[model samples]
Target: MNRDEVIAATRQWIEKAVIGLNLCPFAKSVYVKNQVRIVVSEAKHVDAFLEDLDRELEFLAAADPQDVDTTLLVHPTLFPDFLDFNEIAGIAEEAVVEHELEGILQVASFHPRFQFEDTAEDDIANFTNRSPFPTLHLLREDSIERAVAAYPEAESIYERNIETMTKLGLDGWKALGIPGMGGEKK
Candidate 1:
């Protein structure tokens, strides 16, 4: 898919799986407020993607939270393997610090093959973090803190998501029409 197509798919997944399923209690608030920025990266290589990430970090740091509270950098073709994506994800965190955004921002990763440790590859819990494409969700620390404080039992989100996905199961996920999550696991 092209950049726009990829971004559209990412948005669909967010609307359907994340918000529709209520995986994140805080997402709907910012999302409906138009505070979410989705940027589709045209970077074909890892280094190129990092460069794009640098610019995005600068943009998020400079923009007012009311205008853009968070960003989702949707990268379509760079890291197909979960291990490779996980490795580059570290560098993404480092970039935030390099941009002097430490403690101000953080990166949450989502991928087509997102897998939880100690779980089978096809485990339903993995779907909780799965997205149509490899994405870096840049969020403001203060906003997260506020949301967490207001939310009851925020620590139970993970377990709650697992429960949600387990209820949906793989067949249900496929029914959501998210790309890269079709047919049986290879």
Candidate 2:
């Protein structure tokens, strides 16, 4: 897919799964406010990808939260293997520290095949983190703090997400029409 198509698919997943399912209670607010920034990376190699990541991290750190509260750095074809994408997540964390945005910004990972530790590859719970492509979500620490403070029982989000995904099931996820989640081998 081209860059625009990648972004469109990502937006659809955010709207249908993340917001529509209420998977992330904190997502809807910034999303509806148009504070979510989505960037599609065309980097063809790991080094270039990290460069893209570094640029995004800096941009997000300097951007006004009112204008861009969070960013989704989506890469469609770079890390097709989930394990490689998972490793990139560790590198992404290091990038946050290298940029000296440790306390200011953080990175959360999402992939088409995001398997939680010890969870089977096809476990429904993994669907909670699954997205149309491998994405590194950049978030502001202060925003997370405020959201947590205002949210009651904020700790239950993971369990709630698991429950939501389980209820939705693989069939339900496919019905959402997200690319790469059709329950067929790619």
Candidate 3:
């Protein structure tokens, strides 16, 4: 199915089944491609939450396998304070391989306030303005190698993204800070 169709179907499932179950209080939710990411503030009860989500997904799969895939990324709020984009990308790659998923579904969770120390508000704004998180990237594995080989533009985009993140660092810091300004006084 096309990306838009996949997203629309996933949204319907969330509204109908997920919301009704009260599985978790969604702090933020995004659907792209065929993936759905739901972030909740209170993640202490992730097991119970995933249990319910799994059940709903089962129903969805039975009814419409095209809409819901077996692979899911469950990111509990207590994950870590220092996870970076490459780390997350690696996790996604691992998930795809481990689950034998046709596509990926990623859920990322972390403390909302963590950004204050980890990233500049301006940097965050700039990053989000350029590329928003919880974005849906449609990848057809069967054709990915061929597509990449054929598409120079795709390779360019990938390289640029890596370069940008490297320049910014995972924490977006040239150096640690004093009280107000970034970077400690030497």
Per-candidate local distance difference test: 0.89, 0.93, 0.34
The whole-model C-alpha lDDT of candidate 3 against the native structure comes to: 0.34
Q: Candidate 1 — which residues are off by over 4 angstroms?
A: 183-186
Candidate number that wins on lDDT, 1 or 3: 1
Which candidate do you rate higher for TM-score, 2 or 3? 2
Q: What does candidate 3 score in Cα RMSD to the true structure?
A: 13.0
> What number of backbone clashes does candidate 2 have, counting pairs of residues 3 or more apart or in separate chains?
0
Q: Please give the ranking of all candidate structures by lDDT, highest first, separated by commas.
A: 2, 1, 3
Clash pairs of candidate 1?
A: none
lDDT of 1 by residue, 1-186 (tens): 887788778878888989999999999999999999999998878889999999999999889999999999988888889889998889999998899999999999998888888998899999899888889999999999999999999999999999999999888988988666552442
lDDT of 3 by residue, 76-144 (tens): 233332235334444544544454443433323222122324556444322321211122122334334
**Of the candidates numbered 1 and 2, which has the greater TM-score value?**
2
Q: Residues 55-85, candidate 2, lDDT per residue (tens digit)?
A: 9999999999999999999999999899999
The stretch of ten residues in a row with the least summed lDDT in candidate 1 is: 177-186
- The residue ranges of model 3 lying beyond 4 angstroms of the native Cα positions read 1-42, 45-76, 83-95, 101-152, 161-186
Give candidate 2 regions above 4 Å deviation.
none
State residue 29's C-alpha deviation in candidate 3, in Å. 18
